[model samples]
Structures are given as C-alpha cells and as structure tokens.
Target: MATESRHVTEYIDRPARVVYEYAAEPANLAHWAAGLGSSIRREDGRWFVDVPQGGRAEVAFVARNDLGVLDHEVHLPDGGIVYIPVRVIADGENAEVVLTVRRAAGMTDDEFDRDAAAVATDLATLKQILEASA
Candidate 1:
C-alpha cells in the first residue's frame, strides 16, 4: 500500500460567508455529499455517512471555520483513517472550495481509487448545491 492524497475543488460564484455557512452546517451534508446519507453527531463534531454504493464512514471534525481550517479525519469502515482538509477561499463575492483527502499509509489501491471517485461525486454535488442556492 502507498500513501496518497487526492484533491478536489469547485468554484462557487457566491459570497464566501454564504457558502461557508452552508457547508459548515452538518444538516446540509446530505444535500451536497451525493447521497452519503450524512448525519451529524450531537456529541462530537462527527459526520457519519453511508457511501453512495455501500459502506459507511465517519468524519471527525478536527478544526473548523472558527480556526479557518475545514479539516476532518475520515474513518474508514474497517478502522483506518484518512485525513481530509477542506478550505473555502474567497475573492470578492466568489469563493472556491477545495477538498484534499490524504491517506497517510496502509490503504489499498482499490480503496484509494474508490474513495477518490466518491469524493469527486460529492464535489460535483456540492457545486450543484452552491450554484442552486446562488
């Protein structure tokens, strides 16, 4: 297995604050995560999701917009962890959202590829949501 990182980004023609607010709210995850079956845990800053095809994962929010780091740890179904970093860069009224997913080590090729595809789909969904709201 090899450590790998994947990056996905989408540009939204909207105010950063608006995009940030929508993405930061966990309740909106299901709308933009491509049917990940997302739900936020009230106890911790955890987002639980069921993958598009199958399987489940949990993302524990590490740093949030409060610190300006949209980061989380994506816990795989089998107990492995992948670090996912996301950021929204604002330029005037437009904002770009970037999502970086990194597996430090011990992930199979198939897992990485599958996860990458899932992330890509989620990003597309995010773009749709943002544009729709704009």
Candidate 2:
C-alpha cells in the first residue's frame, strides 16, 4: 500500500537565507511547533521532547545545512521513527516553508486532516515569529 503525504506550506515575508537560518535550528522547533512540545532539551548529545501523552520522545534532528533542510525523525518508545521533511525555498523576495507529513499506516482520514491542520498552524507560527523579528 502506498502512503499518503500532505505538504503544508506557509510563506514568510523574508529572504530565504534569513528564514533558513531560523528554521534550520533544532532549538527553534519548540518556539514554532507546539505539537513537538515546548520544553525540548538536549542531553548527552541527544535531544528529547515531552510527548503530549504521558511520555518523552527521543528526537534526532538532522545536521543543519546552509540549505533549508530541517528534516527530523521522532524516535517513538515503540522503536518506530517518524520522519518529518521540512524545507524553505526562495520565492522571489519571500520564502516558502513546506512541511511534508506522511499518513502513517492505518491512520484514518479524520486523523490525517487534523494532523495536516496542526502542521499548517505550526508553519504559520514560524512565519509570524520570523516576520515579527524583522
């Protein structure tokens, strides 16, 4: 079975370089991605996030690059890794941030819709943060 993926995009009125710099930082995830938890902490060369439920998730973020590639994987306690692919592309004088979410196996349509909406909200928050600073 093929998995379904949704790409949620938000535009920020800033240069791609500036947006990329802000978005590529793993530490910034807490400020924008509320679904990822607000209290992400790094310890022993590993980052961890408090899951909304009753547990903490070990998160491994990809190395930051000059290009806006903020892909990360959430390491679930059940040994499953959920990959989140995010990018910022230059759009003339502005920047477009796109986050791709894949519908996990057996996820219902309602769940996927809610997940996509959450991702969109997160991206909007990101745009607001970067624009407000400029």
Worst lDDT window (10 residues) for model 1? Answer: 35-44
Tell me the tens digit of each residue's lDDT in model 2 across 1-134: 88899999999999999998887776787998997776788899888988775578888877978777879999877778899998989999999999998999989999999999999999999999999999
Q: What are the TM-scores, per candidate, against the unseen true structure?
A: 0.72, 0.94
lDDT of candidate 2 at residue 100, scale 0 to 100: 95
- Clash number for model 1? 0
How many residue pairs collide in each prediction? 0, 0
lDDT of 1: 0.71
User: Relative to the unseen true structure, what is the C-alpha lDDT of residue 121 in candidate 2, on a scale of 0 to 100?
Assistant: 92
Cα distance off (Å), candidate 2, residue 79: 1.9
Scanning candidate 2 in windows of ten residues, the lowest lDDT window is 52-61
Candidate 1 residue lDDT tens string, 9-112 = 77778877777778877667777776345554443555677744457888676544553356766677888676668887887878888887665566788887
Look at candidate 1 and give me any clashing residue pairs.
Answer: none
